[model samples]
Target: MAQVDRQQWDVVVVGAGGAGLRAAIEARERGARTAVVCKSLFGKAHTVMAEGGIAASMGNVNGHDNWQVHFRDTMRGGKFLGQWRMAELHAREAPDRVWELETWGALFDRTPDGRISQRNFGGHEYPRLAHVGDRTGLELIRTLQQKATALQQEDFAAYGDHEARLKVFQECTVTRVLKDGGRVAGAFCYERESGRFFVLEAPAVVLATGGIGKSFKTTSNSWEYTGDGHALALLAGAPLLNMEFVQFHPTGMVWPPSVKGILVTESVRGDGGVLRNSDGRRFMFDYVPDVFKDKYAQTEDEADRWYEDPDGNRRPPELLPRDEVARAINAEVKAGRGSPHGGVFLDVSTRMSPERVKRRLPSMYHQFKELADVDITAEPMEVGPTCHYVMGGVAVDSETAAAEGVPGLFAAGEVAGGMHGSNRLGGNSLSDLLVFGRRAGLHAAALAAAPGPRPRVSPEQVDAAAAEALAPFHAREGAENPYTLHQELQSAMNDLVGIIRREDEMAEALRRLASLRERAARAGVEGHRQFNPGWHLALDLRNMLLVSECVARAALERTESRGGHTREDCPAMERAWRPVNLLCRPVEPPPADPAADRIRLERVRTEPIRPDLLALFEKEELVKYLAEEELPE
Candidate 1:
């Protein structure tokens, strides 16, 4: 075997997005040496794709807004299937996290009163999203990255080495999380620039590698979201929670084919945009479900008045939770009321003046004009549902962010499960990243500082990882092409286990996935490892296939529809299924049969909501989602 580079750190954060950067900062501040590994260039992680804003209960725009209201709204948005403790923690801490960012030099757009400005988003009770125009995520990354740099500068003054306390290993991908006995030891990684292998030896490894959207054909996610963290956790024996729930955002680019799945930020509707069908009808009003009828306005007059007097009028139907809105858009298109590109019209041109549109949504304006040649100020954009987020992820402790069943391993951001439950609200994602990212970092640092011997990284595991990564280069003639295998996997996942799912389709998806798994084993590349994207993709196929199978299997196991997992055969949300979380665990050892299942699905009951948290919602509202036993007697 060739010699491999080796480095030692107290904490290894396997990503550099909002969560990863935040975690690294916390770990370094607590006096632990940290290393941040990312697949893209530093500061270019998928968090930059988040455009709407960060959801926090700062109450700058609405005095009625608070952590309690935010908590209730989050539970309702997830249809009460979320981890109650995680949601509570997120709502309670999000405000402090946002304020902390400001102290770290984040400059947010402000209200006339000079407070951080907040904006409306789907499923929120008030204007709770703190933002800087439509590019809040970019601003967030800028602030956090600068903060990390400042920490390095301070370390340089103290230790005479900038990277003595914290360092970033950019453009690197982790193939495996190496373990000693039952605890996390480190990670096996390869640099994308040179394809050189190395080991980052650490007691604590934080997985913040974001979502699994790239497995589907039409997704707002970038190439990096191949379920890397989720698969790594599963392979290391941590179960994935609620893998069936996947969020398809209500609005994504639908025209010109080239940019079909690019995100159309939810800020448009939050700022008075409406969803209209071909007949120019405000179709959302007619599609509001019984559960949300009282909350959303029925008449256009009431809906329009909500902008000026939110206290006196119900919110517009367009502002319903993303799941409802996405399903509505899907229904409209299926009913033949779709736009020329097989989507519905999202019009802000008629509602807001051109100046306001440009001032508020500069990114959306440029995105459409540059990508699809559409002028949004004068015309409505053709938009439809796109696979945006996966609520299922590595199951972790709500308080510590430590991955269950894996000592010294932690997870946060989109990679950690139980925070958002089945469906996440539009702006909650950024806040979730901040709140839990900090917790994960704090606990991981503490674990690293514990009095004990460090876990050992086994040479056998490193050799196996290297051999697996190199297998694609040694394939025989007539081997399956990695690109074709990827496309087939995407098509299968998108067509069968997409927004709307059924038992038969999902079962067939499992069948197709089995065959793909067999062929993916023989997936080959035509080039050497150095700067070889083909080789990288062939390696990524393993994670993609694993996560996709988890989705199909869990989607099939759960019979009822709720949040992102909608079943046509079982359309109604069953109260019985609300408290039962489906956990996906990898099948132990190796199976000889090619068609054998790789992941075993287990149903675990969720913790009962605390008494005080239960008191936040009215009994009548709770009756809609909770089972008879779950509600207070």
Candidate 2:
């Protein structure tokens, strides 16, 4: 091969975020040697950018809140396109996951009786998010990292080396999932700083790389989220489930231009903020759809009363699911009711005292004061939709977290589809990380520990990955700039295939994507690989282009408006489309020319919802989302 340095482990994890760390912890505990690789510093994964709280049906805040209600809320939030089993599993197990964090030294904000205090969030029937001010994600990452270190400490005591069982490789990126025939063998990776290529040969690999938000112009994602995991899975012969469902969070910063698209946490709304238009109208009241009308307050008086007496009044329309709220903001902006910066106003100043605002949303308070020179406790902030989470990802078995058609590959968190369906409810993401991350690790460890010959890492595949990585450095004449190509790609996706969609716009998006893919082949970087950001971006462009094609292609094929995916031409939520999932699988023998279509889209029927689970919802409610054949007699 190319004299690449190689290390062997039982399980190799391709991310170091909350899910990756949790998976590593589970794998090591199951007596497997584990390694975690990430593109950022150990604790700096996009998980830290998650500002709200972890969703779990603990019922600490409201005794009536239980798994059934949470499950129903999840399915409804996804517009009933979510995989029912995954929703059931997440609802049932999330409370234990949250409580487990406490056992591992997580200090969550507590209630009067000293229980983990849960707060209200969009799409939930009750107060169900376990939080630590507005920085719950940071605390979750800290807790998982501590748990991993504690295991390492135990390993050091017995084996005389801290890294004897589990180790984390920070500032490293996995470019390929190496395979022997059809089964996973390991991963091909590169250290970002030294530009050195290496391989981690293992029987099993868990992909926990977050999402593909960076493919859009205005996004809440960090630079590292260039859809590496999604691309890796697709190239390795695993299909991505429904790449069309992209979430544009309703409250990204819209002013000062420099800080545009930075996330303003949903905690702002969950903790008392309200959305208003330029006319100083609480416009959310005017936008509630038929499905959610019964659950939300109809008037300002009722909405305000629900904050203190949630049992007596329905939640404010401001707490509607993210897809609904994002579309509402877009509507307000389009109608010329937008703020000076082209977004609606999100205000908390009139709702709470300054001290309470600072106490409940410390990170948000500081974020606005320092970044935008605006004190959130004194005035409303300019906010709009920005591309955030992707609901589509690697298709996997609901129980084992194992990717279908790929023997030893598994995925969890935002990289795995079907859990959130069409749109994820606020706060469900952190709990999803804990619940399924553990499942993937347990199953991956079991597979690695099986008594059988290990899959051999192919040298030919390793060499090919190395060649592809190096191609950007050696460019032909008239090569394109990586930065400029990336800008154009982001613009195309944001304008054509974003929060709302149409047949012609998405078709045009696919054409632009194909051209971008051709130019991306010639993407050139000026500097040497060592610590060169341009070189890094050039490598990242391949992944972005591949995933962008999946998004554009699948978005055009699925012709209905549901949750995060809104088709303007086909604006109604079609019950007939509820049972279908659109999968993006890579074309066999990928086209030799980069300009040719490389992804093939297929339609797969979703597994039927269990009868027992279906009974939880009122038949009248089920009729709205299910086809006549799917409904119970």
Worst 10 residues of 1 by lDDT: 304-313
Per-residue CA lDDT of candidate 1, range 1-633, in tens?
Answer: 657888999999999999999999999999999999999999998898889999999999989899999999999999999999999999999999999999999999999989999999999989999999999999999999999999999998988963588999999999999999999999999999888999999999999999999899999999999999999999999999999999999998888787789988999999989999998999998888887777889989888788778564389989999999999999999999999888999999998999999999999888889878889999998899999999999999999999999999999999998988889998999999999999999999999999989998877888898998899999888789889999999999999999888899999999999999999888888867787998999999999999999999999999999999999989999999989999999998857764678999999999999999999988888898898889987
| Runs off by more than 4 Å, candidate 2 | none
TM per prediction: 0.99, 0.99
RMSD of each: 1.1, 1.0
For model 2, how does the per-residue alpha-carbon lDDT over 1-633 read when each residue is reduced to its tens digit? 788999999999989898899899999999999999999999999999888899999999889999999999999999899999999999999999999999999999999999999988988989999999999999999999889989988999989863589988999999999998899999999999999999999999999999998899999999889999999999999999999999999999999786799888888898789999999999999999887778999999989889878665389999999999999999999999999989999999999899999999999899878877889999998999999999999999999999989999999999999999899999999999899999999999999999999999878888999999999888988989999999999999999998889898998998998999999999887777798998889989989999999998988888889889989899988999999999999998998999999999999888889999999988888998998789887
Q: What's the TM for model 2?
A: 0.99
Q: What does candidate 1 score in Cα RMSD to the true structure? A: 1.1
Which pairs clash (backbone N, Cα, C closer than 3 Å) in model 2? none
Runs off by more than 4 Å, candidate 1: 593-595
Q: Give Cα-based local distance difference scores for all models.
A: 0.92, 0.92
Worst 10 residues of 2 by lDDT: 304-313
